[model samples]
Target: MPFTPITAEQRFVLDHVVRVRELAATERFAAASDDVIDAVLEGVGAFAAGEWAPLLRAGDTVGARWTPEGVRMPDGYAEAYHDYVDGGWGTIGVPEAHGGQGLPFAIQTAVLDTLGTANMAFALCPTLTVGAIEALAHHGSAEQQRLYLPHLATGAWTGTMNLTEPQAGSDVGALRTTATPLGDGTWRIKGTKIFISFGDHDMAENIVHLVLARTPDAPVGTKGISLFLVPKFRLDEDGRPGAANDVRVVSIEHKMGLHASPTCVLSFGDHDDCVGELIGPEHGGMRAMFTMMNNARLNVGLQGVQAAEAATQAAVAYALERVQSARAGGTSRDAVRIVEHPDVRRMLMRMKAQTQAARALVYYAAGQVDRAGSGDARARGRLELVTPLAKAHGTDLGNEVASLGIQVHGGMGYIEETGAAQFFRDVRITSIYEGTNGIQAADLVGRKLALGREASGGGVFAELIADMRDEAQDARLIALIDACEATGQALADASTDDRLAASYPFLTMVSVATCGWLMERQGRAATDDAPFMRMKRACVRFYLEQIVPEALGLVAAAQAPADVLYAVEAELFAE
Candidate 1:
């Protein structure tokens, strides 16, 4: 059912702007010579429209079934897995030397967008696999690399990060998993890991778990944690599967959404000798693990993109199909479609603008990821600054877009059969899971801001603002750039005193303000590009005018001490 009224702005972003191939012509953006992104997208579209899309409802309705053996995923997931792996979709971003296609994350992001949109449950497995591969590729030993990389790269085996415990949650320092050194170079791991994705599955022959545990007599707190590569099945010298290791899937989480994803609770060394190889050096697991976590966060950000785009698509379809009563300007005899209503237009427009802007941000960041390898260290640091922002903000945008999607449907949205409610439930966890939005804000202020503080000798986030301003292409983009500067300046001024706590609201405002600002930049860059470029420019205008205005209040709130948020008695409102 389509909306009764559709605004011109909403039409542009929702109906006109194409998928991930928008900036595929950008040379540095393409990881593969062929249209790998389009190819994957095409496959995803076919699968989604046919086999996979049908599962979306089943996933939400039926969810996953838990049994003594493990969580039984929806039917046909293994068959889907065979196609996904055999098609090379799983290894798009892995290095070519390790038997992967070594595609750029941008291309992979597009593919992922399709996969998640098709059936989010199915996407979680490979997303976690890519994260584990990232950790191993960066920190694994040569022997470890030779043993695991090929299989990981080829999608012949899957991987998991054994992080959370029953009591640990997001705090890694509280984990009590122990890794005892054996006489040989191997180690025996013993402990339980909760919420592990694809923890135990017959999808693949082996599962490589990058586990964090402590050595005996090690220093207390996070400093003592070490990362180990513990496999569900040990690999032989030739990298093939050897003996089954001592790991068992005790149970799986019965989550509200992503039902196809098996959230497993794994018990390691329930026997006595679970052999595991160490990744990187001892007591340095935190650093190595962060590599995976950060990469995973970025992937999580793209999952937001997936949700936003999918929701946008669904909203547009609903708006066009649903024929409601006449608009205020029209009589019942001359009844207009609900898309003709102004308020409906406003909601859809904001949704379209924000979603497209997020896509542009992540796409550019994807380019930056490629440039980081070939560019200077400063170039690399700049990429690092955008990483958290993209991950944090992109996912936030997902929820916002999905919410708007629900709003567009109104009464019908509340109905479970409409599927609008499902989108809302699925995207809700993005912000909380990958280190809460609060955590992302603190990292930006502490780590990235600390770097800016040292370099400028005083001003924080100023260089970025200045660089953005200078890149402005037209009068409007420049004006919006100035507004972001004012926002950034307010944040800088608020942080003048060394004892001051930086307001997260300020960080959030500037983050959105910058996103609005960059959308304009992207629009301007597309001057010579395509209809997609025109769509981008139009959305940029919408973001600058509609989205950034919301920042005014947040900037005002940033003037206050951060302790105010902390001081609030959260428990008082619990009831």
Candidate 2:
């Protein structure tokens, strides 16, 4: 099945669940009228479905290759990227002062969903660029912004975040990359950054690399790190890309999936003289990088949602066409479509409900970002609280749904030709990158919940639980909310090690309960007697009765003692 943009579903979530209209009422997004939003959705949907979707299979099959010149993309990718740039799709949420459309991030989130569903590998390039745009717009000096923002916003120049090295995967403080000051207000950046996506791609004129490195006399850990704006090509007096910089793409990683995206190993200043300018205050790289990290994390969650959507579509399409077992009760001897079977139907419903639930949560979080843009402190806190859940649960759903997609195809799914396995392969990365799901769970329990009350005037988790309880009209939903509240309180009261042990299950419970809340709202708001609304009602019903109950077990698992996890001796497994 060709990729289709879920425009109606996106609009429904934006209007009913996310309340984008309320966001529009704010001064920051007041100019984003209904027509503007609709136009963007329609245009991007067409571009994604027509231009980008066709390249999906080719991208996976042909993939990207590293050459002596640069990282060469798959066939038709450069053309598609050019079309993306020409269409102005890259600038939806960027500020107008930087030659962008200046729309709300909620709208941008919807656009990203469409793009990601069409082709995740292609979508990743823009994803990193958006993060870099956020970092520069928030922390870059005026001169730096003037020099970089326009092309970046316009997609003429792409960007990459360089924080990880061979030794520093998640523990960024352990990185050994270095930067030395030059007398001309520039620094020479010397380091090897691994897993740098789009690090040396040929689609754009210049690649703006935001690097994290420590100064010579700086302290030993992350506190000593500083951010640098190092372009692939140095700028001339006219501010255009001029000479080649000292950044080299040593090689690209051959990954399990998203092969078309070049995950490069970058070497900077191997012979010295890689000029870079400081982004923010010295020794404050982590603070500035968080701006990008936060943006990318939510976008990664949306990647999960998109992959699930794509997988579900393919599975349903296959189930309808592939004839298999006979009808359970009928007299007919002919084999019926597998979709008619009870188990297949159950699997399909599970896929649909989980995907919709993830979509609602992510869109709601995006709406909170828009509110935060308007200086709403509570909304900001709410966003921070939900970020981990959105990242962890959403990707988990992606993996689950994709696996189900393969099962729906039965024997054919195991073969690469069926296309069902591709989703499973592609979605596996969403949980690992942008910080692993385990890291996200830890952040939720150890950091967010621990300090949420002091930062936001009230506990974020507590406030969300209360909101869910208030909105939950069904008894089951209310019960689920209560369970989530109790688990959250336990996390609050538990010791650090206990909280860490419980973090994963607690995060899962939060995601399920929150989805139940949003689904209930979606059900209430969907009043039409149309088929789509009927499907919405059925999906929400299945989610509440069949899916939400998983939270009960998660709650129990979350409160288990930490000692249980480490009780076994390390060498005993070998025996």
Top candidate (TM-score): 2
- Candidates' RMSD to native: 4.5, 1.2
Quote model 2's TM-score: 0.98
The sequence of per-residue lDDT tens digits that candidate 2 reaches over residues 1-575 is: 45877888999999987898887887778878999889888899999999898998988998999899989998899999999998998999999888788888989999989999999888999999999999999999999999999999989999999999999999999999999999888999999999998898879999999999999889888899999999999999999999999999999998889888889999999889798999999998999999999999999999999899999999999988999879887689789999989999999999999999999999889888888877888898899999998888889999999999999999999999888888889999999999999999999988888556875555887788778877898888788788877787778889889999998988888899999999989999888899889999999999999888877767778899799777889887788
lDDT of each: 0.72, 0.90
lDDT of 1 by residue, 43-129 (tens): 656655565566677767776677775566667666777777777777777777777776666566666666776666667778888
Model 1 bad stretches (over 4 Å):
1-31, 34-51, 452-460, 473-502, 525-534, 563-575
Candidate 2 Cα outliers beyond 4 Å, as residue runs: 455-458
Give the top-scoring candidate (lDDT).
Answer: 2
TM-score against native, each model:
0.88, 0.98
